[model samples]
Target: MCSLFRCSSASSLLLAFGMAVVTASPVVMSIPISAQNAVPTLLTSTSKTTFSDIKANYWARPFIQAIVERNIIDGFADGTFRPDRPVKRAEFAVMLQKAFEQKRVRQLNAGGFKDVPPNYWAASAIKEAYETGFMPGYPANLFLPKQQVGKFEAIAALANGLGLTATAPASNILNGSYTDAPIIPNYAADAVAAATQANLVVNYPNVKKLDPLEPLTRASAAALLYQALVWQERVEPLPSNLKTANYIVADVNQNNQTPNDVVTVTASDSSFSILSSLLKTAGLAVILQHPNNSMTIFAPTDEAFANLPKGTLEWLQQPENRETLIRVLTYHVVPRKRQVSELSEGKLKTFAGKAVNIQVNSLTHQTTVNNAKILQSNIQASNGIIHAINQVLIPPNINLSKK
Candidate 1:
């Protein structure tokens, strides 16, 4: 026979010990309780799981771990988390269903999409996502389940699923935040802006370059899902500098102050105006302005441009010569930030993905990068340091034709 105790103050302790306790008077009066018909409650396992492929230093490791621990996502059968692989629409729908609860607005007699048969594994999830307003079907009632989702589509779906609306102007939010703001479609502008304000957008290598058209990767999707959970107050925010948090509000006041990046410094300096204009033409300025990236630039003065064989500079500026222009400009940029004091004679990799030899004269304390002689050394910038050179360093592969 089993016995039961009616103790008000010891209810929690009894529960932890797998026994049921009832609340009674504090005077410790024993009241008879029935144990013959009572059911026992069981405790659940709360052990943490880790993936084999994900490492501590990976950019999206935290987000991946967050989703995995919540049982919203999983690794592949081979015990690897292929973060770089693309995610399909149907797979994303299944993940969305597992991550969030939705109330069924209505019932559909048939599967919402013609492509998704009733026997399909994810048919129910797709239908629920459509009915709950998380995703919309394509034209002719066709939901391309196998199609890879793009970055913009993922952000738009998250915004719609959570019912987020933009409080500020779309143009102000997008234009002020991303360098590719003009390319964002009109229909998705507001959704993207709302996602940006909610701190959902995360870009690697360069946070400022929001390549919306690129296919959404598995790692990227995990990051977005984690941020959505944070927005919904379902998860605690993680502390990290790689999150690209609060970009719009922080950069809004940058116009008044001098920017610390090499591109902005060159643009503001009268001597480097020619180089600045060329950088903009080649679409390389955006890379130099990336908030997370650090690099060293060997800027050539206006006099160097003037010294170019007559019409050479003009020919490179033409719209048809954009690729050649990019290659030429990237040849001047080094991927790592280095000061003059750290200089040693060795081969260094440039942003162009090629190596350039650096020579130092111990007697005169002079430096030369490639074939260009340094006219000025140690110009400090926020992202990296810069040195002025007397001549433009051209890559060996580029064949510059005289116009």
Candidate 2:
């Protein structure tokens, strides 16, 4: 008794959707400014008419090559692309313009940067970048064209230019007590934060802090653009061989209490008593009861829970680690009731607020996580659905995949 609908940007785009037979449900999904459903096509129009055979240089190789392949940018005669070289302001402006034009994004006008005089080449492109809220010049309107752009500055430009906005600070995003935010130049903070939330952070060698002022490397630029593309939903599908496990419905209340009605599995029927212990410890026994109509659990089987290191369960038993234990447990449960048929092949945003990639093999009737496999299927409960799994599906330190 449900229906699906999507209102894509305008009243003209509204559509009533048909119910999916396998899941017996209506799925209403609006297309985000993403590539998951439809990829944005870019024209391969480069300034170079016909360049000689060239090998793109490292540092800038990937991005330069990608741009060239996508026909957004190009290089000169020697046939060697110098990626480590700083990107000129003019070049960046042109790239930004091309990116937007290819995507058919709204055009932006340069409101008049002091240094980028109207007479300068690519003025419109530079202005469009600024007007689109991608890159803004200094407060006095000076466009420091000659200056080498830094990591943070370039990231900010990409974020704003691509229309990815920053979210408010999440309550649980462990910054590892990062204090670099205060040190980031005011102009770049917004960009840094926006990129960070979009998973564009591949900060290596120096993971703790983002040195906003440091000049960006060519490799870093490629990674940044790639991630920006991901944020825009230009993406890939999960591999078919990845293993997926089913979760059990342990629909707990806000207070972490399991339901009033409990289904006890005999010790003979299950292996690890971790479920009982974990539940009691999480203070969640009160919420996992009968009649949970809309919850799903990635229930780890007894043997799987028992497979943990000998001292692992015992260590979790210690009272001091209660909060940590709660998170571990909550990480396994998603807010939605997902049936097997509903899963699609790709990275999915989980109910636990992280992402997991899922791949299903029609030939095997099996689903996989990055590599983990689901051993069982829908185990229904009055309150929700539980899918028993073989291995203890530990939420990845990063996140989990939901399909």
Candidate 3:
């Protein structure tokens, strides 16, 4: 058996179980390696599965573990998963070959690219990758197998190969989801948009930063492949972790139902009785019930309304106090849809024309709006997402006592 030291010493670029070096004759060669450049082992093998560099809290750990366990990719030979390491085109091809079993759509020239000789370790993988339509070569027959694959390119390839097409305009999806949308190459925009719609794109640390031109890291690759598998329905979905869930750009068209869904949920919930009634009285329910109007509501529980100053609710309910009631209700409503994960520490302009202060406690994992803690969140509705707060948010410049 080849020892780990000897395997790491080998000059091979990552020929793992998933990215294995293959011969033209199709014989699987066994290579003994540490986690660094070795064949990715399943979780069943305790000795080979643990990568020294991947911490329990690492954002990509779940994705990497999933990919490795399925023999889709692997770490290095030094017992460390250098997740940030860039993956070359050939390496990506090998990963695609292992990760997907899509039926072949078409076959290219058998002679293959001038750059990829038959003896090349990844030659077979590259051939399969292009022939299956997952990756296409450049004009003039250049595969550029050694070149590092960019994040957008990899996503585009996956989306194209999977026959996923953008349901909406490319510009609409890109501008809404990515902060660096302007930099996304025109050629890959549609495919990337399709990939985003399919939830195959995962950005870590910051979800809005697509870093389109950045080279795809091993961690990013694993995350992407995992999502692709999810889209293909080959594996069951993983449990939602904050680190991963917040970063997945779910389908933009997911909330297409009538706004009655929102109105019904709020009106039916006993906890939101106070909020639902106030909205109806203020006439904001008309707006919330309209399918064209997208909005977010920081609904205060009935208990929160009771905690308000005595006579506050009574004063607002009076016919003379209707205007004040509208203002107060609008204060809790913000334009457009926002999930709990989208809330950051900043001022968010409310429908009342005044902004509410948003405070996020990273250490405590709590979000507060105008000092009111979010007791429950991410209640999905047709028009938007609703969050339940512990207190009613008052608009600035409103004097409840005088009213």
Candidate 4:
């Protein structure tokens, strides 16, 4: 009986043990009646629980409430969520145990960790998390239960536990996604990239700054865990603009409109100087710069234009060849804006009234249109999306075989 009451909180033990002593019987009580019944009844109830400190307007309040309603996490005895508080490793392990089912890859040993004794409060949870691949212990077989978890460690744990892997190079994913990309630890880059790709990363205050080394606050943990639940199809994604639903790439356009116009923004980039000049010369600038325009432009860099055979560009600029130039330029423009995720291996109709063959490599997440390769992708603009390609796409009528 004493062993059953050993790991519970002092207040809970006093209340439960006092009742048990008064009702002591000759026969020993069962594990459910003694240990399980002695714990809090929060899980047994079906109604939603609310915390005094967690207001509806709080950024992560919805996430906290969702997890709380599912009985995955609980508030403090004082009825506070303490959203800003750093979560301990033990607390995280317990949450992970309740949140996911055990899918052990190996046999469990008699003793799991050096520090987690059998009677410790989180011992079972720690073991379950370790066996299920949600959490791993430190070097020398140590489980630092009381240690504070970091943001990257939490992301890595979720990524690994869910068996997510990066489909693209870690450097490619991280380089343009976050401002503090260099600070991400080498070992965790792939896991973080997978997390970002899955939309499991939710940053508060600033979406682009992934502070990987910062302590994992309860609010952030709830948001990330909620995203994980969404990833597993256990719950629907939150319908809030405040939630970081996608990776925030650095805004290259100087105008920085909420939904920037693609042609105007593309012209702002120095690398697209030749394309911008060609757009103006082709009398196509007005079509793209229109406020309501929506299209995808495969803009080629200056280097791509320079690679053309000598005098090829000069001939295209001639007054007699204006119609031919328009066909070539319009071939690179698609009627609708298609982000990277929307692209697939197929043929898409261009503004020139002809189709361009698009090929996508699922493994590397690389995309190509015709003979040109998409160098930089998902450059968002209000009017459309601009994908920088290595070579200019030409229409079939505009033959450059001789050149």
The TM-score, computed over Cα atoms with residue i paired to residue i, of candidate 4 is 0.51
Question: What TM-score would each prediction reach against the true structure?
Answer: 0.49, 0.42, 0.53, 0.51
Model 4, C-alpha of 77: deviation from truth (Å):
2.6
Deviation of model 2 at 348, angstroms? 24
Candidate 1 per-residue lDDT over residues 1-403, each given as its tens digit: 0011122344432332232222211110011112212212211222233667777777778777666666556665445667887877776776677666644434554646788877666776778777666777888888787788898888888877665554357788788878898888889998888777666777765677778889888888887877776554467566656453422122332455666578877887899999999988877676567654456788999998888888899999998888788778877877545655455689976766577889987656678888788887656455666888999888878777543
TM-score, model 2 to reference: 0.42
State each model's CA lDDT, in order. 0.68, 0.48, 0.73, 0.70
Error of 1 at 289 (Å): 35
* Clashing pairs for predicted structure model 3, backbone only: 17-39, 35-76, 36-75, 36-76, 36-77, 37-76, 37-77
Candidate whose TM-score is highest: 3
Which candidate leads the pack in lDDT? 3
lDDT of 1: 0.68
Worst 10 residues of 3 by lDDT: 22-31
Better of 1 and 4 by TM-score: 4
- Superposed Cα deviation of residue 315, candidate 3 (Å): 62
Residues 101-166 of candidate 2 have per-residue lDDT tens digits of 322224333457677666665566667666666667676767765556677788778766654433
Which residue segments of model 3 deviate by more than 4 Å?
Answer: 1-47, 256-403
Q: What is the lDDT of candidate 2?
A: 0.48
